[model samples]
Target chain A: MDMIRRTVLKSAGATGVVAGLLATGMLKPTLAYADDWNKAAFEAKNMDGALDGIGAKGAADNKDLLVKAPEIAENGAVVPVDVTSNIPNTTSIAFLIAKNPSPLAAQFEFSNGAVADVSVRLKFAETSIVRVVAKADGKFYSAQREVKVTAGGCGG
Target chain B: MADPMKIRAQMKGDVAEVRVLMSHAMETGTRKEADGKLVPAHHIQNMTVALNGKTVIAGQIAGSVSKNPVFGFKVKGAKAGDKVAVSWIDNKGDKRTDEAAVA
Candidate 1:
């Protein structure tokens, strides 16, 4: 018990030091964690570019990957999207709005026996194809659904 | 500062259905305020979920997501009485973490 307490205290002290460095601007905020935000991927203007930015180029269409989205979104500002993959050993799932100024919307990585299921709300600039890409077994599979946005979400 | 996320976890059979509601403006950095100045990009950049202290989902999000984003996922082999913790870090370095008991 004494050893565990000491270890915990040491970790706490280390965290405090890191936080202090961040507060003083000595350390970049993104470097505080292992996972860094991929800004370029999310800023890509086209579907292919976005996929390439995320190292998911040449993804093949697969029926096992399912993307569920509204056929017609009354409010383009908030469209619900859900994706599920039946493929085994799925590692990641990413959503893209093909017509948005920036196509990549969200990307999720799964581990520890988590199911390949994700639901998120996305914004659409206009009528666009909602695409979902799943990485499994070192390969990428994709599925898409067209969602007609009656109103634009990017502009007033 | 942002409001704490609301997380719910329930065991359906052996699967744990986790739902999270994150309170954020999700500003795209393009919108103009009343003063006609562009609002800087401020959105959740990363999210994580853990079941019984084991990470099950890690997500990277962008400003294209809708405001007050809602996310849902499923975790296999999760049982009642387990703990489900959800956390998110925004682009501005703000973070919030909240947990729920599996039911």
Candidate 2:
């Protein structure tokens, strides 16, 4: 633990120097390391809007895209969801919840021979269908599974 | 500034299984404080995973993700001792990057 903390501190210091360089314009910011945050999709109020934001509104349903999640969750704050896409040339995967205030949860773009399987922890506002969408060969495919949350993740 | 992420990478046959646990508050603006004041949204906005300095996965997320988010991924063509780096930039412009070697 001590070693880990020390390492963290060392990295933090290094980042601090990097930040300083960036602030002083010594290091030019490059687009290579930056990715655009999908604002329209993430802030969408409904699932359909979220789907549209990600250009998956009319995505075809495919069984090859598998969504594995608990059927019932006691706590909505941290529900584990796993996705695997068997589609050939799969390039990206996205998660959308039907009942969250903003339905879009996350989206991941894969490349360079990465596997199309991922596991992530998400929050569900209530009972909702968690949708997984995969983009392959310029086409989109999706799958969904329902999860019942006894306790709400979003606090009132 | 944010806490460092915990990353683990292991060779599972021909693939490298990488798991990352990030420390974050992930506070949504909807939630209120004890005094009933709405908490400002603070969460990870974007993340990237790199293998030996090459990006393999790029992600964008929202506050709907749970606090201290955990994620797992699989990378192909990776061998033991190869570097795997994971980094994220949050809504508040806070960022953290951590790396691990496939074992």
Candidate 3:
């Protein structure tokens, strides 16, 4: 089980060099990526800002959305989270960590008959509520699950 | 050039299940190094998945994602041998794209 998750781990030294270059103004990131990344939402500082940035401030809670995560995460570094929306015509799904510095962790827009299901790993600073919000037929619905982080607990 | 992304695509019934592992540091820009200097933020900001050259999943990822992020998604109407491509661009302007055939 651990081997599966650990498979992606590799030396990050190359990325560190890129970071240094960007910091020193040696390399410039193209503005072309701005159209795809949601800067407003990802840079939002608070929960309210995050919700507003995603345009889900008044989202209604729904049971059709499923958020699967470990009740207690032994490690906060790589907590696996899976989300599935049974609601018809789900156009998008967004994952938000209630207490994260930016709250809005990730968001995916689905189209061309793509299923509104996704699995991803997230880093948690501490125990926090994992919120899943989905948009279907122009209406926003949400569901949340609390994941407890046990410090020093072993994870397989 | 950036490291190649590991991509796997398989047909689960009629839907194609695509999973990808991107190589990144996903720095939060708030962490302090041993020298007490802030680590600059460097994370995947944009990602996209395409089935047979058609867009299926478009996403925005942040530093909150774990390092070497793994993502799984399913696409409908995909058949065996169909092409699946995954691509991403980080905040530092680094980009990577890899493709796999659905089996």
Q: How well does each candidate superpose onto the true structure, as a TM-score?
A: 0.86, 0.85, 0.88
DockQ for model 2 equals 0.45
lDDT tens digits, residue span B1-50, model 3: 67898999988888888999999999988788999999978888899999
After superposing candidate 3, which stretches have Cα over 4 Å from the reference?
A: A1-29, A154-156
**Which prediction has the highest DockQ against the true structure?**
3
Residue-level lDDT of model 2, residues B47-67, one tens digit each, is: 999999999999998999999
lDDT order, best first, reads 2, 3, 1
- For candidate 3, the docking band is medium
Q: Model 1 off-target regions past 4 Å?
A: A1-31, A152-156
Error of 1 at B16 (Å): 0.5
Each candidate's DockQ: 0.57, 0.45, 0.63
Poorest 10 consecutive residues of model 3 chain A by lDDT?
A3-12
Q: What would the per-residue lDDT of candidate 2 be over residues A1-156, giving only the tens digit for each residue? A: 344334334434754654553464423233223237777788889989999999998999998998899998988899999999999999999999999999999999999868999999999988899999999999999999999887545432
**Residue A90 alpha-carbon offset, candidate 1, angstroms:** 1.0
Give me candidate 1's TM-score against the actual structure: 0.86
The pairs that clash in candidate 2 are: none
Return the number of clashes found in candidate 1.
Answer: 0
Candidate 1, residue A63: how far the Cα is off, in Å: 0.3
Alpha-carbon error at A89 in model 3, in Å? 0.6
User: For candidate 1, what is the lDDT?
Assistant: 0.85
